[model samples]
Target: MPCDFLPAQRALLDATEHLIYTGGIHATGVDAIVRKSGIARKTLYRHYPTKEALVEAALRRRDDRWMAWFIAATSGYTDPRARLLSCFDALREWFASDGFHGCAFLNAAGEIGPATHPIRAVSRLHKRRLFEYVCTLTRETGLAQPDEIAEEFLVLIDGAISLALVFGDTHGADAAARSAQRLLRHIPVSS
Candidate 1:
């Protein structure tokens, strides 16, 4: 992973992210990134020695940006349980967004075959962060078995993303949110 990026490198990363998000990691070639970034091939190589390196960096960038966006989106609700439920609301909004192409990490994972692949590691890291955040929310809400609840929430979130992608609609989020509500109904919310 790059500790820092030069202006040219930033351009390359941005272009690579856009291309990979819109297209797939394997489908977006180095030439495409260079063309989209308007950066020279030599400059790109200088910044990233290999395509895998560039892909990993782009995924890292997406993970940071996406997580920040999600946190901000869900931060508006004050109640702990509301905050937990806000995740699904945020997902619905994202699903309806113009640039939404499903979870970038999930998409990348499918494209990167090997479990040992660096891109796969990036994908796993993204999910782990998401799960941790959900766990924090569940704990704050005074939910019993925070780990289990968080795991369930993560599953619903991922399932909603996958369904939204497959159906080309926001109903998946709605369904997931409803299911989540039912799941939480049995758990006592902290006052």
Candidate 2:
């Protein structure tokens, strides 16, 4: 609810994010988070109450930071079509980045499979926001049925990311981009 986190809270969150990304949700315990953050257990409990709560906060923070990065990366293209395609380029860059470990949301979902888990809820929220962003880009293209096209585009995007992660192939993004181009060609542009 509150974006304004205290110094200790921020530290704990940062530690959690790094640890979870490096190890995993189940592998990274609260004790590790506290030790890495240099925050006492009492302080962590004061802020988060439970490990699940801290995990949710970390995922939320990551969602915010990742979306900001993605939007900024795609902003360079003036044309809506080009901007839409640029998302794949961004993914390629991400895949090639050091310490790249695939989509955090997907990873979190896999690690915490229960549908009712708070972390899974956060992952779902992140995905919904991604779909919404695609819809925004599609609207800018002045295409017929932007919402439907955006949904299809999101499927391609997610599929590409999953393929890249599984096969360790950056070219998957390019393949996805080509498919996106084909999909875009089918949608009639507004006059």
Candidate 3:
């Protein structure tokens, strides 16, 4: 959903996203969100009836923000191939950003137990959107198997994020970019 949040509601979501991103979803509570937001408990609940609902909204907001930033980061290059490879450049910047804990969707999905949970569903949707965007880029490059190349690229993207989080390896994205270049070299371009 587009963030058409009221001032108070936006505050609540900003606080929720920060706390959850830095501290994990299960560990962060409504009380902390209320306090951090400086919005009264009643107001928080008024905006989001349940804690889960607030989390969902916050994750949605994060998804919108992350995707916009990512698209902007990669969209500058005119060449489809450069634009595709710029994905890793974007990741490198994100991995180095302050309070970068890893992919928000992955973190939220990990904390939630049920496969059918709304939070997990949101996570899946975020990944699906990202993958679809990659597909568009690969197809634009005239790759013979754009879908297959997209799948490999998405794996590299996820692997870079995971390795960066686990090892504090700032160069993970660079390595992923190199691997992507190698993958592109092997894949036959369409006539």
- Best candidate according to lDDT: 3
RMSD of each: 2.0, 1.6, 1.0
Candidate 3 lDDT over 138-168, as tens digits, reads 9999989999899999999999999999998
How well does candidate 2 match the true structure in TM-score terms?
0.94
- Note the residue pairs that clash in candidate 2: none
What candidate 1 gets wrong by more than 4 Å, as runs, is 1-4, 188-191
Candidate 1 lDDT by residue in tens digits, 1-191: 34577889899989999999999988999999989999999989888999999999989988998888999999998898899999999999999999888989999999988899999999999999999999988998887788899999999999999999999999999999999999999976545
RMSD of 2: 1.6
lDDT winner between 2 and 3, please give it: 3
lDDT of 2 by residue, 48-147 (tens): 9999999999999999999999999989999899998999999999988888888899999999978998999999999999999999999999999999
TM-score of each: 0.95, 0.94, 0.97
Q: Candidate 2: minimum summed lDDT over ten consecutive residues — where?
A: 1-10
Residue 116's lDDT within candidate 3 is 100
Model 3 CA deviation exceeding 4 Å by range: 1-3
